[model samples]
Target: MADLVYYVAVTLDGYIADSDHKLDWLMAFPLGDDATPYDDFYRTVGAVIMGAETYSWILENSPEAWPYANVPAFIVTHRSLSIPEGKNITLVQGAASMVAAQARMAAKGKDVWLVGGGKTAALFAEADELQRLFITQIPVVIGAGIPLLPVSKVLNLKPVTQKVLKSGAVELVCDVVVG
Candidate 1:
């Protein structure tokens, strides 16, 4: 079974983006570690699932034609969207359970990454479907924006790995105890 890992960057107060859905705040910080972690993550991720908000944000901001060129990505959205031709992307519309089932099926041997905005991650985390959470805490704090995680409930996680980068960003790897 593939573990669903939520890998994301958050601020000190826990925001994924600003009010305008711009990640300029994230870019303000000096680049911390290289793509080693992302590379390692991609190696283990056979498929990825993300919220519409996050997907749209990347589509609008990413410079590359298709940021997730090789990898298969699924975006959960209510609105109809035409995924760019020749891209390994899918659109899934349904409840969290349905989405998880589809993502798991696609993941097969590798892991499924829940790359997203707070609602998606929080839903997976609440459902106990999110197996692991790898958060890279950047050394910056935006007074207000989208929070990294939802403020609805508390999630109990066990620390498995911890690494502090030279740029003061700390990467925390934790396991989501799902029954």
Candidate 2:
């Protein structure tokens, strides 16, 4: 089975994006030497699952083409959205378990990248569908913004690994404890 990994870059205060739902703060930082972390991770992803807002952000920001064109992408959204032509993207609405099952099948033994927007990741985490979390902690603190996981209940995580990047960013990997 493929592991559902919520691999994302977060602020020091645990925000994925600012209040405006923009990544301007994150984009300001330069990718220091050995910036291949994302490329390395991307090589292992076979499928992707993201929320509607995340999808919309990508569409608006990356107008030229879809970033994850090679992988099967699933967008969890209640609102209607259009998929770019020739892209392997699916718009779905349902329980996280159901959506995760589809993503897992599409993953074909590779990992499922949970391209998140907090709410969506929370759904998977709340449903116990998320397996791992890879958080790249950016140095800045956004004060207030979208949380890393906005679940009402507590979700335990076991640390797997930690690394400090050349850019003073920290990368922490953890396994979502299933109880």
Per-candidate Cα RMSD to the true structure, in Å, reads 1.8, 1.1
Q: What TM-score do all the candidates reach, one by one?
A: 0.91, 0.96
lDDT of 1 by residue, 39-94 (tens): 87788888889988888888877747877776788998888886877888988887
Candidate 1 clash figure, as a count: 1
Best by lDDT: 2
Best TM-score among the predictions, by candidate number: 2
Q: What's model 1's lDDT at 80?
A: 86
What's the count of clashing pairs in each model shown? 1, 0
Note the residue pairs that clash in candidate 2: none
Residue 153's C-alpha lDDT in candidate 1?
Answer: 65
